[model samples]
Target: MSEPTSPESNPHLTLVDHPLVQHKLTLMRAKATSTATFRQLLREISLLLGYEALRTLPLTDTVIETPMQEMKAPVLAGKKLAVVSILRAGNGLLDGILELAPSARVGFVGLYRDEETLKPVQYYCKVPSDLADRPVLALDPMLATGNSSVAAVDLLKEKGAQDIRFLCLLAAPEGVARMKEAHPDVKIVTASLDEKLNEKGYIVPGLGDAGDRMFGTK
Candidate 1:
C-alpha cells in the first residue's frame, strides 16, 4: 500500500453500487434472513465486489493460438494476487472471490477484539512468502472501528505487501477515517458506508456480527 499523501482524507475508498450487490446486501441485512441465505448472499456479493477491487490490476500481452489464427491476448501480469482474509468473517468474502480468481494465493490473519479496550489482538497469521511480489486484496466483512482492519494491514505491510486493497460488506465513517489516517494508500471497497458506530463499537443499522450471521454461531 502506498503511503497516502493526503493525511486528512481518503480518496482510495470505493463504494460498489452494482444492482445485484445492493440487492444481496439488502437481503443479508434483513433481521429475518436465515444463516444459510445470509452466507449465500455474501458469497454472491463478494464476487461483484471482487471484480471492482481488481479492475485496475496490471495486464500484459501474451501470444496465444486460437482455432482461427495465432494472436496476442491480454493477460494478467506479475505474480498471482494474494488474497488475505482477516479471519472468520473475512472467509465469507474470501470464498466468493476465490470463485472469481481460483488460482490466486490465499492467506489468513486471525484477530479478535478486546471488548473493553475495543482493540484487536492477533492470535494467528500465515501469509504467502512472496506477498511483496503480488498485489494483495484484504478481505473483512465489516469495518466497524477500523482497529482490526488497520492492524491487519500493518502486519501485511510488515510482511512486504506494498500493493493492498481492503474489501468489506459495510463500513462506518469512524472506521473509514481511522483507516485513512493509518493506511492511506489502501483502497477500501464496500457495499455501504453506513452511519456512525454504536457505543459498543458496531456499525449502526449494519449487518450484525458477520461471522455469527454467516456461521450460525449467534
Candidate 2:
C-alpha cells in the first residue's frame, strides 16, 4: 500500500446515513444502551452498512440454460471477497457482515498498541492466500489514532492485497487524516465522523470502548 502524502486529499472516505443505519447507530451511542442491546445493534448496523458498501461491486452476465430457455444471469466478477476483522472490536461488525455475506472468506488480525512505543504490534494474523486476487474489507469499531488501522493495512498490502476497504462504526478526524496519509488507496466506510481524540486517545464524544461495551466486560 502506498502512503498518502496528504490524507485530506483522499476522495473515497464516506459516511453512510440510511434511516435504519442512522437509527440503530443512535441507539448504540446512547449511554443507557445495555451491553446486550449494543451487541444486537452493532450486528444489525453491520448488515445494513454492508449492503451499502457492496452496492458498487462489479457483476458480469453469464449465459445459463434454464429449463424453458437460455437466459443470462448476473454473477459477481473476480475473486471471492475477504472480510478481515481487526479483532475484538471488529468482531462485532464481522458478525453482521458474515450473516449478510456468508460465502465471503474470513480472516483476522490482532494488534495492540505498545504503551511505551505507542506503536502497533501484531499478536495474530491469518489472511487468505491470493489476497491480491480478492477484494478485502477490514472492519473495526473505532478509529481513534488510526495507528493500528494503518499498520494493519500496511501488512495486508505487504501480503499482496491490492483492493482493500476499511469499515468502522465511528471515526475521529485525526484518525481519518492519519489513515488517509498512511493508506490513501483504502476506502473508509463509517457511520459517524466525530471530533478530535482526547488526551487519552479516545474519540471525543464517541461511544466508549466498543469491545467493553459490546461484551459487558466492565
How many residue pairs collide in each prediction?
1, 0
lDDT (C-alpha, whole model) for all candidates: 0.92, 0.86
Local accuracy of candidate 1 as per-residue lDDT tens digits, 8-27: 35568888888998999999
What is candidate 2's lDDT per residue for 1-218, written digit by digit as tens? 23322234557777887888889988988999999999999999999888877776778999999999999999999988899999879999998999878889999999987766667899999989899998899999898889999989988998899999899998888888888878878888888888768877888799988999999999
- Where does candidate 1 have its weakest 10-residue lDDT segment? 1-10
TM-score of 2: 0.92
* Each prediction's TM-score versus the true structure: 0.95, 0.92
Native-vs-model 1 lDDT?
A: 0.92
